[model samples]
Target: MAHDPITAVVPAFNESETIASVVAYLIRAPEVNEVIVVDNNSVDNTASVASTAGARVVTETRQGMGHAFKAGVAAAQNDWVMKVDADLERFGPRLVSCLANARAPGIGLVKGAWQDPGDDMPMTRLLVQPAVAALCPALAELTAPNSGIYLMDRSRIAHTELRGNYAVDLDAMLRMAWAGHGVAEVDIGQIENDRRSPAHYSAMAHEIMGFFLDCARASSKASST
Candidate 1:
């Protein structure tokens, strides 16, 4: 199968401090053809910085990460899309490149897997992993289903029901698997990110748990029929 060029999308919110390097990495990556930054109601100079760093900038009025990503992907000029967080400090070869290289002919979604330097992904280890094992056993091997960095083909999402919340990552993976799209994962290496307050993690855990429980209930109902 022939390879398709990828559109890199960065969903940002007041990430002026790190957005430049993020966009620069994507632009410099061999697999990326275009870089787009969706500024999600940022009060900072994220948009200007991204543009200066050689990225096309767009704005999303919505407040959630899922909304920002949807807006960026909607504006993507390429069928293959790569999206990542703007706040992370990446030091190795671009994770986008790694994900793109992992792509196979039948694979529609390529998820980025990385070791967190600070073990910040408690939600993934504790909650999301078990939910995935129960819901989609095929994806139970994924170590970072909640990772913000991933590459996906937009053409495969026509009938996939995507969530607009923090569980969006898991939602996409599960939906794509349910849609019969091949899912692949690649190790993107170690990534460093600032630690957030416990309160932030609290909210994230609540949202993720709620989404998985709802999915469990739905699955039970479907099986009972």
Candidate 2:
């Protein structure tokens, strides 16, 4: 895909402190035409803070990343969309180029791989990510399955069937592959993120495993038919 106006979608929950910085950096990027922050029913002043930062704010009452993302995508007015987390402070402008380079011909989805080898990734994530990579072909038909950052054409959104909660990213990728859309990953440099606590990590692992297993069974049934 050629360069065009990109709408950056940020799904935020109780992210009042960091949302402004994230939106500010995104708006400063020339390639990014707009920043849409979807507040996931946050009890804090996330919407107010995002509005002060000049981000177009949308409210999703349902408390899930996928629900926020779907609202943000639906609200975007640009041709291209990039979904990013609100807590990333040092996401460089080079991220735009990375996504652009990853856009293979006929590919609508491009994911960014975190490139810092020294960065601390959770132990559970490290173990689970490999399991995901091994199971994805039979489950989501995905490579780089855990990549959360994504750049995609807006037209593809209508064809996507995003499930609620944490399974959203995996579900969307699987549907995209099933629809024959191309997907690729680009190196987006190291991100300094607050690692999830052990309890949260364990919960995430369980959720991811359940989704993967469900996908695997569905894929198997489809193949058997």
Candidate 3:
């Protein structure tokens, strides 16, 4: 996989401040052949800055993280699509190397797990992972089950139906494994992110929880039949 060219798919919305830096960093990686920024109708200069920094800018008007990712993947020219957020948190060019290294193990889907030795994040401890494990045990293989950073083989996930919101990453993990693709998780080390407002955080949490509830119901029905 090291020899294979990689495309870094970055999703941004009003991320003008960090978009350029993220694109520059991704372009520095030798494995990365293209750095595409999928702007989700940003009001700022996200598209211009990303384009200036050597990234091909595209737009996803549907207004969601999942939609941005779907658009990026669809525009990818490389067989391997690496998803990186425009916030410049928990990701860099080194991520490309890690993904390529993990590919040596014959894994088609590689998700980056945030390394928190302290294990203090309530989202992981109190909510996301536990709920996912309870609803779909196999998808629990990833510690950072909802991490936005991941590298996936385009063909393996192209046919899967991705949720249009916060649940996309978790949904992808489940669908990839169910499709018989080997999934692997790698540590992305510590992350530095721009803090979102309380209201924004709450809304994201609500959507994520709702997606899982839907997943739980689907799983129950499948097993019952």
Candidate 4:
């Protein structure tokens, strides 16, 4: 039986150290039709390494995760898109299987969730989820609303709205949920990411809160109009 092939979209910036391995793994996946690596103007050799690893390379000069991701998805050739973090090395075939198996009718996206050993998602625990609960309640239910790895439908997500900057993941999930698309989560076990600094969390909080405020203002204006 033939199954629909998925395009793996990886948005990267200065990820030469880890990209080759990630691309190699993705290219070897039977369900993955092609790996599209969007090089976000890296000062390193991410593009060349990705290409050598069997990924179709593209460039997104805008220099942000959102811009890189949009460019990668735009170049995707499959209906289903699997987006994984370029920096993370723990993602494996199990995570891919989990996300793929979660797809069903009316589902717009599948979130690949994993336990953080350090519990260091400070922005998510402190600000993002709280703001989402107030502005986009449905999105707050997600275990990892800020998760960088997930599978989405190209047709659905390509047309979806974006809040830009660091809030791309949250923005897409919020819009999809509001658009009557079902969200599913699959536990792919533990994936330990590096601990971020206080200043990093602060910047993330600013972007996330700004997005929520924009949503609040828009909602207020809509109701009044």
Candidate number achieving the greatest TM-score relative to the actual structure: 1
Q: What is the Å distance of residue 25 in model 4 from its true position? A: 1.4
lDDT of each: 0.84, 0.76, 0.81, 0.81
Model 4, runs deviating above 4 Å: 157-161
Runs off by more than 4 Å, candidate 1: 159-161
36-129: candidate 3 lDDT, tens digit per residue: 9999999999999999899999999999998998888888898788988788744444666876678754577888876544445567667898
What is model 4's C-alpha RMSD?
2.0
Stretches of candidate 3 off by over 4 Å are 89-93, 116-119, 158-160
- Candidate 1: give its CA RMSD in angstroms: 1.6
State residue 212's C-alpha deviation in candidate 3, in Å: 1.0
lDDT of 4 by residue, 101-183 (tens): 78888888888889887876766778777877887677667777778798887676544346547878777777778778888
Q: How well does candidate 3 match the true structure in TM-score terms?
A: 0.90
lDDT of 1 at 62: 75
lDDT tens digits, residue span 109-130, model 1: 9999887678767778888888
* lDDT comparing candidate 4 with the true structure: 0.81
| TM-score sort, best first | 1, 4, 3, 2
How many residue pairs clash per model? 0, 0, 0, 0
What are the per-residue Cα lDDT tens digits for candidate 2 across 1-225?
466778999999999999999888888887788999999989999999999998999999988877888888889897578888987866666876778667767787887877544454554256446655555554333335666788887686562357666777766666666677777777787777775667976776677778778877877899899
Question: Considering lDDT, which of the candidate structures 1 and 2 is the better prediction for this target?
Answer: 1
Clashing pairs in 4: none
